[model samples]
Target: MTNTETQVPLARFGISAVEIARVVAVFYARVRSHEVLGPVFAAHVADWPEHEDKIARFWRNAILREKSYSGNPMREHVSRPDVKAEHFPLWLGLFHDVLRTELPERTALQWGALADRIGEGFRTGIVAMRQPKDQPPKLF
Candidate 1:
């Protein structure tokens, strides 16, 4: 990549709400088509349209500080039995891929780090939930 592409300014560009919505929509579309994760996601998201809206709001809040999302992500994931430790890495990989493909280099890197942190947090949380209550917490 050229220096210009690699060194894009860090200013948020004030990415609009509509643009953020588009990003979430496109990302989820890609996720739904993924071979390794599609079935797991589909099985868990019975009302995918609603789930999509919730996810869009979450991303908007995360990236734009919009306070648009109020749902508990941990609660949602923990409630689903199919989401396991291994699934997190797969999900992060896919998310990183999508960001890289759809966004500028700087933006991709920014989002990639965020994705990694969130994935690690979720993985650790999920493992903790799976453990016996009497056992000490397992650090990730």
Candidate 2:
């Protein structure tokens, strides 16, 4: 586990709650209008504003260690049959576009790197979920 004291704060990279909120708001707006992502999110999210607020909180918790957000992101995504593993790339592409446009180059690069790492985690979890229960972990 990473010690909070040792971990570098995202704010050092110019990632504040304000920046998190902006990214969530703008990225989701594009997602809602996107040809591929729109339908997937629309089916689950009833209130756009409320969903955005929750997502912003999630980003704050993740990036800022606010400890104010709730819900299991991996469980949420894995539960959705429509959220295929391939969708991670699509999601990251749009998120990267939003991050680059909303933040300065250095900040965007840092934040995008973090997002890439997290997206890989989610994709790995989803892949594990699809594995056969009777199958044992491979021995190297």
Per-model TM-score, in order, reads 0.81, 0.85
lDDT per residue (tens digit) for residues 1-140 in model 1 = 76468764333444566766666777778889988788888888788778888887887778776677997888778878888888898888888877777788877788678778877988888899888999988886
**Which regions of candidate 2 deviate over 4 angstroms?**
1-12, 134-140
Report the C-alpha lDDT of model 2 over 104-138, residue by residue, as the tens digit: 99988988998999998898888788768899843
Model 1 weakest lDDT span, ten residues long: 7-16
For this target, which candidate reaches the highest lDDT against the unseen true structure?
2
Error of 2 at 87 (Å): 0.5
lDDT of 1 at 103: 80
Whole-model Cα lDDT per candidate? Answer: 0.78, 0.87
Which residue pairs does candidate 2 place in steric collision? none
Question: Model 2, 24: alpha-carbon shift in Å?
Answer: 0.6
